[model samples]
Target chain A: MTDDSIGAFRDELIDSGLVIDAGVEGLYGRTLAYEEIVSGIIALTTRTGAGDGAMAVHFPPLIPRWLLERTDYLKSFPDLTGSVHTFGGDDKRHARLLALVDGGHDWVEVLEPAEVVLRPAACHPVYPLCTGGPLPTQGRRFEVQGWCFRHEPSADPARMLCFRMHEFVYVGDPDGAGAHSELWLKRGAEMFESMGLDVDVVVANDPFFGRAGKFLAANQLDDALKLEFVSPVSSTETRTAIGSVNRHQDHFGLTFGIESADGEVAHSACFAVGVDRTALALLKRHGLDPGRWPAEVRARLWP
Target chain B: MEEEIRQILEEHGRLPVPMADLDNNADLYEAGMTSHASVNVMLALEDGFDFEFPESMLRKSTFESVSAIEAALTSLVGTPVE
Candidate 1:
């Protein structure tokens, strides 16, 4: 869609009280109506994955800086990662910081890099926690939900700087990890379809940066490592990726020294949905009011 | 070009088997080169050849084997492989 149309749609949403204007691109507040839809999508995931022996895991939006450094995410997506900063200084520096702020000068340079970074993905912290030991013989499955931060500010509402992701992470042998991703690939699509959303599972890759990143993205696509469930949240001509199934292929296991029951490096995969994006897609499809949405779709969520 | 490519692979490919045992048509990924190793190999190749790979050539097919790397380099340099 054209920029004007996208902006018009966003204005309609704001004017209708679905999304609150935060005065920042890619960062907005959601009204209760929007949050209710987000909750409904999360409920669908919880209910559908109940029979899969998944354990619920939750984390704050901040993760250790050391762990983020260990991952190759920085190498591939340096442009999109967010690192936290804080005022770690003596009283003299503190006074200077306040004076700069009072004088309308640059105060951010006085802040130091903090030990924590904004969590880039919901599943990142889980890998290191499972290290230093062998996983269960059959493997481990976790249902994790948290706010993920990516520093790509854009005019597109679908591309938020901070968003919620409800993810199912699996770690174990190659076959188990592969089976988990495959199972979710079907189940995830089915859940969205039942909720009256158009679902298309397509082979996809991360938006890697630079020339070398092109090769990495190509290799990822060549291996079919990432698959996304895209729907028309913004424009039908360019559907937004509301969810994804990704295969880590022992990258995290090798990085964190995680081992399987057989003493080999474990493989990992995750099925994750962008809860906020899904909510927007639902709003686009079913209309603004949940009470007026189709009965079958409401039944799928309310049930 | 072929020998240089093989040397770069041996240093950066992280393959389980020796590069000498593999044929020019052998798939390096199947020979145990991980995706991380591929990035290193690509960087090493750029430094060794003194030429940057174009975005179009940044693909698995371009670096799948020794012959493929040689062909890609030949095209980028616009000269016959030595």
Candidate 2:
């Protein structure tokens, strides 16, 4: 059985007659998936700094180890961090690794795809920086659009291993925490609704405790993972979680000892908009017919 | 204390454990307890008690088991465990 989402996007790509990766195999699909996802991320990031004076920052796709360590990333998500490693030996070892890359798969596992592990979630990169900087007396907030990686071996294209994460952060605000989350939630709804996806708000939980996540999953529930916007795709409740209004609830703030004007520690929240799947959901929602949908929306995205 | 921890585990989908016999030096990591689950437990603890779990107390040994969590909660609440 195929998910209606991947099926819908696949069909639309076929109908559009765009080049789908001709020789691709398995669930990753063809060219259209890549084009649609990359293009979708491009379109979303281009819309920021619109009237809110939002400054954008794009960090390295592979975050440094020290940075993740400071935020106790391993403690919270050891299961997710990808560690960068290599053969620890003399220059001969280094040469062997290089030979593999140049010789096209030779020299054994010498270059052992060591990692400065690919970032699992995008927000961890931002937290330590916020801690190091001079934050707002009230709180400093910024939005970043990042490409994140996960070890999801699931074949679902929607659950692709490499996906784009669009997350906005409201940091440093101690007393104004609730106000920030509320504002982001309102902004997120307008964006998803405008994209023409039938959106539904849900309270979700993080995928940390595999079994403990049952409450969120039993009825399609997630833990304190307060999810507000899910758009209908195949039928109804099976809609994708295109966007999440996350209240990191000062988890980051508390981790870093981020403080308000008086120097009292503050908490912060994040609103993550999963840009890639959201675009897929939008395409599914609008029938992937460019002509049938409003040209202005398309023009804004394409333009 | 063991019963309280069991209730949290049962209600929260966390792994149940026998923490009464578990001492401070006991190896919690080898006992099926994980730091990832500890965060969930922390969140559950917050919701269960309507109080905040300070990040200051999030050290490795803090969430060793049911007894440890109860001790932390007891300290935060300024009272002995029932």
Candidate 3:
């Protein structure tokens, strides 16, 4: 999309009271009306038999650095990771920090690293919790909702640095994991199509880091392990990945020592829906006014 | 050309098997070549062969095997080959 269109869309969102201008690129506050639509969309999409027996888990936005280290997140996304830092200054240092802030001289240098880093994805925390044992005979499923942070800052609202993801994760044997992801791929497509959005399910991969990451992305796509449900959010020509169904074959299982009931390293998969991006997609497609949306679309989201 | 491709594979493909042992049409991924490694190979190929891969040729199929890579290069360079 052109910069002009993106700027216009941002203006429309702010003018319509759907998005509050936080003055920072890639960061915006959601108004109550926008939040009501987001909550309604989440409720509608998550109303499913897929998560029937899934265990619900809630995670804080910040995860332990040790846990993140175990997941190879630091290795793959060193550039995008955010660590929590706090001021650990004595009186003298505190006085210096105050002076720096007062003079607007970038006082952030005084803050020391906390033990936790902002969580980058919704599924990483689930892997550690399910460690130390084999899953049940039928496998295990979990439903998680949490804020995720990335260092990416862009003018596009859909590419927010901080956003909430509602994810459903499954751990089991390879076959079960594959089946679960495939099912979600289909369900995710149907869910968005029913919502009146033209969605494309495409083979995709992560933005792995540096020179080696290029091959990683290609291999992931070659393996057909990652599928994205993309829709036109910011621009019609450029689609955004609003949801993704990923099949991680024994990667997490081996790292966390999780096993399947059959005595092999378990395979894992997760389907995550970007809640805010979906809301933004709705606004982009159906216009800023919800009243002008298709009758069925309005009913499904607002009713 | 084959030797050049093999050299690129050896340097950047990170294949678990030796370059000589890999079949011309064998799936590179099956031999433990990762996506990250494939990207390195792609860049190496572009540099060694003096050709740029278009967006259409950037998918997994383009780097699936030695034969596939050879084909992509031949197509990009627009030359006949075995």
Candidate 4:
């Protein structure tokens, strides 16, 4: 598929006020795109809430190291987490460094290790909370927007050092988990369909662990745990995975000991939507046309 | 170059700010810049310079003022912008 459309759509996003101007090199890096996308989801979620009790959740900007530690996040993907650290020094030392730099010295500090790592994924905390408490009824679900951080130096504006991740997490009986994923995969399709974009729902893979990631890449043809609702971004990277339905098997349930009222092992699943990516995808698919946009789609998104 | 950066920040709601406010030595954060303002400033820097602001540079001290951000950016790009 020629992605001339995605590039046009990207330009349209900047026009729609969904994206601030792409920086110096333009689309390659240093652009801002958030306002339009957030409002778009707000409109979509409101539509979903008309018949559902899906409460919106607000989480902290950063998650704790302990929260990520239990999940073996570092083991799974150490490359992404960002940590905060400070140099161990008295005011005098700090003053001295400041003095040198004031005198045109190359002032630098080695600093201590980071105390807290930034949250890379939106669902890390949700699963832990599920584990601590009893599994409620068979069909409880929740949704939230998490501000995430990544330590990538790619300098791609399409990629961000920090980004907002929207996730609808379903945890409860095993069957309920399946139901949530099934419903969202369809729901996500509907959202894209409404936007007049060509969308594909494909079984996709996560950035798996270690040397295994290379192994998984070779079989890019296979891998069932991933279901990505993909739209084209660049011709080279067509699958802009806006959302994914993940079956955590029993990994989270086992770790958190979350159980059904009847004490059966609970299951866990999540639908993660890169809200920013979705806006970008819309830009790629729909050329920034307020007048040309379907009234119903505009009403659903803008109103 | 600094004037252009300041003008961009001012237009983007880096309020209580004047065209002449962010001198080369003022500590913008200590002078009471808000986090939201910091983000806006970061956005402007990105657009103006075609640079990405790393999380490592999000500290209160980094946006201390025009000079601070310039220093941070200098280290990042490894040169002074004349």
Estimate the lDDT of model 1.
0.88
Report clash pairs, candidate 1. none
Superposed Cα deviation of residue A18, candidate 1 (Å): 2.4
The model with the greater TM-score, 1 or 3, is 1
* Superior by lDDT: candidate 3 or candidate 4: 3
Tens digit per residue, CA lDDT, model 3, A170-287: 9989888988887888888888887899899888767878644554665676688888999999888899899999888776776677989988778899999998889989888888
Error of 1 at B16 (Å): 5.0
- Per residue, candidate 2 scores C-alpha lDDT tens digits across A1-303 of 356645555555556653243333222433554465457546655574255554567876787766666565565445555666666768887887787789788555664544366777767777776665557675766677777776654434456566678777777664566777777778777776666667878786455433333322332232343666787543344766777876655456655656665565556777787776776675566655545656656654566
Candidate 2: docking tier: incorrect
Model 3 spans with C-alpha error above 4 angstroms: A49-51, B1-82
Evaluated on CA atoms against the true complex, candidate 4 attains a DockQ of 0.01
Q: What is the lDDT of residue B5 in candidate 2?
A: 54
Q: What share of the true interface contacts does candidate 1 keep?
A: 0.82
Candidate No. with top TM-score = 1
Ranking by DockQ: 1, 3, 2, 4
What does candidate 1's lDDT look like per residue over B1-73, in tens digits? 7888899999999776899999999998777777877888999988987989888888888888888888888
Can you list the residue pairs that collide in candidate 3?
A215-B35, A215-B36, A215-B39, A216-B35, A216-B36
In candidate 2, how many clashes are counted? 21
Give the interface-residue alpha carbon RMSD of model 1. 1.2
Segments of candidate 1 deviating more than 4 angstroms? B1-7, B14-26, B70-82
> For model 4, how does the per-residue alpha-carbon lDDT over A1-303 read when each residue is reduced to its tens digit?
344654555465555565554353233232334565456765675475345565567787677778777665664467776787667878888887788778887665535655576888877777666665566685456777777876664323346566678877777887887887788788878876776656789887556445423333323323265588887653335666777787664456655667765676677778777766666666555544444567776677777
lDDT by candidate, in order shown: 0.88, 0.60, 0.83, 0.64
Winner of 1 and 4 under DockQ: 1
Candidates 2 and 3, the one with greater DockQ: 3
